[model samples]
Target: MWIESTLIAVFVMVLLLDWITLIVHCIVGVGLAWLAYSLTTEAPRLEHVTLIHLPIIFFAVVLGTLANYVTEVVRLEQERAMLATAGSIAHELRTPLLGIRSGAAGLRNFLPALLSAYQLARENSLPVVAIRRSHLATIEGVLERIETEANYSNAIIDILITNTRLPKLGHEDLSPCSMMRCIRIALERYPFSVDEISQIAPVTGNDFIFEGVELLMVHVIFNLLKNSLRHIAMTGKGEICIRAVSSSQCNQLVFRDTAAGIPSEVLPHIFKRFYSLPATGDNILGSGIGLAFCSEVVQAFGGTIECSSILGEFCEFSLKFPRIQS
Candidate 1:
């Protein structure tokens, strides 16, 4: 009987040891998994084997997700702070820029008058004949060009300010305008001209009258179109296609371009403020506010903007909006 009791005691001790080892293993696994997630760019995908660690793995995943969320929140806060600071500095600088531009324009306008007076004097007086009228004309032309450039700079600064200020949407009913029609209208208003409008199709959604800001939405579409055009123009032989389709629950508008596409490495940051891809060329103008504004507008309207591209083939952007229920 004593031997029997002794055997049972030994078995109980062994069972206790096994449970303790399992717990220790789980704690170790969770720590390692979390470390991996923290160090990598890729998201964590927990597997069935990971569940063998149970509560420990679950806590680790939760902690990892929380960590990621905190990181993003912090990043966004930093960006917001930077944007505010830059906007303030730009506002202060704009006053002087505007003054300079205005003075330059006034001087340019009076330059032609001054040249004409000089010519008249030269023609009227024998001693002044040595001053050639051509030299005076050249000086006037240079001043005019400088004034034109100053005006352009002021316009660019105005656009930057407009983009920095997040304007609220106007609650106006938008008619169910054809996606093609909207594209055509936006294109007409755009600064550049297109030889042809290719492969654009109709889309059904809330009429342009839906509750949103019409001008801002138009600006978003126009910006996307301009971006596509800029890329296609670079290729010298490319086209842009606009298409829209309505699924049961959502409506999608797609803009596809046949130009050399965006590189995969830069695709993710395309919508980020001031984040322009090097492959897009240094000469690409604008403050890199276009796509970022589009993203803001889409999100405001409860939609999403997504891009897909192949390095040498094509780039496509999809805008998805939830169908408005009557």
Candidate 2:
């Protein structure tokens, strides 16, 4: 009956939980069974058998309980990690929301005044002063501001979904997406602060197409751009040069930033899930999931992404895809 029960337990537990977890439960279960057998079994040499089994049972129970305790501890730690990740993600979301609100506020103030001035001129047949380029820029900037913020928000949301869902790629959809188009779209969408856009130089006429989703590639590039931009801001040095070039074997997109680069030790771990650098000096929000998310997406698309950096010099990420036979 005990053996049958163990078999039944193993079968059901395997169906419900992972193998490692099931093994842990089995250890504890087996230990408890030994204890019960020693205490309640009707053996012929009752006292002698019980005496021998007592210490063994005790040791088994202790070992099993310790294993169970460790498992629970690991689970609690994971829960705490998830909480921290949620907090960081929430903080990131706020930046874009603030930008959207600020842009809307700018439009709110600028539009009414301009319309009123136009109405005044019509009513009194008075000449209106020439609008300054700065004034016109304000309106366009506000629109760009809103767009950039919205795009930033969407990128983060996609990262969050990818992290949470852990979805596997199956037969879904694929398309031929141009590399140059992706780079331009990410540049247009990223919420760059004043004067930050000037630092980016994207070389043109080096276009190639890959079989993948455009939005996914855009977000991946967004992650790279965001990291590069942040490092540039932090170190106050370097410019970002983006270009796409194809080789005989493969076509690749190069995102090279001449900024304070990643440390040699940190490079290997950058793409790990929930791995992030500590916040420092006004750069309050950071995420560990972005690069990991990019890796996951690119791998799912049947491609590769790699990063190399030299501290104080530059960091470059190359995303390569299978070359199409022309």
Candidate 3:
């Protein structure tokens, strides 16, 4: 009887010990899970924990994902804010720069005549030989250079303004406007030749009244035309085609150029601000803001812009705007 009782007591002790170990393990697991959850969640409530009761590993993963998502969202918002501030400052600078360029050009154009008048007055006073015509000619030449520089400055200012302006939505007046006529008007403002523009496809639209600023639209088209001309001028033989047609859902304008197209790697970032392809040499006069402006304008008009290119074949830009209601 004594041996049997001792054996039973030993068995019970072993069972109790096993139970204690399991409880300890459970506590440790719960503590670890809570720690992980606290670290992951921004502000985890006790009620929330009870409701979900997620596994330790799963909870950690969920918290990690949420943290990453929040971080990314914050980062994106900051970047957008910075872009907007930069754009605003750029817009304000353009008008003043344009005025300065105009003023300088005017001065350059009139300075020679003013100098001539001054020389004439001096000649009438004392000695006929005191004022040299060669001196006046030299002055005129300098003025001409100044005028050239002023004109160049104006061009730069225009490009800067074109790139930075916030896309403004215009009132919709859906009507059939001649796409060809608009193209012609825009081309007349530039130095492109008739032969160059003749290559574009004829386009017409019924719900043509797009809901966007006319000036911004012009800038978009002008940039494409300018880009084409630049390529043609550089390579000596290139063609550009622009076509417009109405789709069931939108109005599409397509621009294609025969020059060496943008590389595949750089194609995605072409619309990004200040992102320019390295192949566009130093001689290229643009400020790299043209396409950025085009993107902004397109988005403002509730439209989409996309590009496709084969390295040696061609580059194409497709602009789609919402169709105006009749």
lDDT of each: 0.64, 0.72, 0.65
TM-score per model over all chains: 0.57, 0.59, 0.56
Candidate 1 residue lDDT tens string, 69-92 = 666689779877766775676678
Clashing residue pairs, candidate 2?
Answer: none
Candidate 3, residues 132-250: lDDT per residue as tens digits?
Answer: 77877886677555545555455545555566555445445323344445556665564444466565555444334566666567768878877777776676666787777777778
Comparing 2 and 3 on TM-score, the stronger one: 2
For every model in order, what is the number of clashing pairs?
Answer: 9, 0, 0
**TM-score for predicted model 1 compared with the true structure:** 0.57
lDDT tens per residue, model 2, 150-194: 666755565455444435665367677888888888777766766
Identify the runs in model 3 with alpha carbons over 4 angstroms from their true place. 1-53, 57-62, 70-74, 81-109, 114-185, 188-207, 229-239, 246-250, 272-293, 299-302
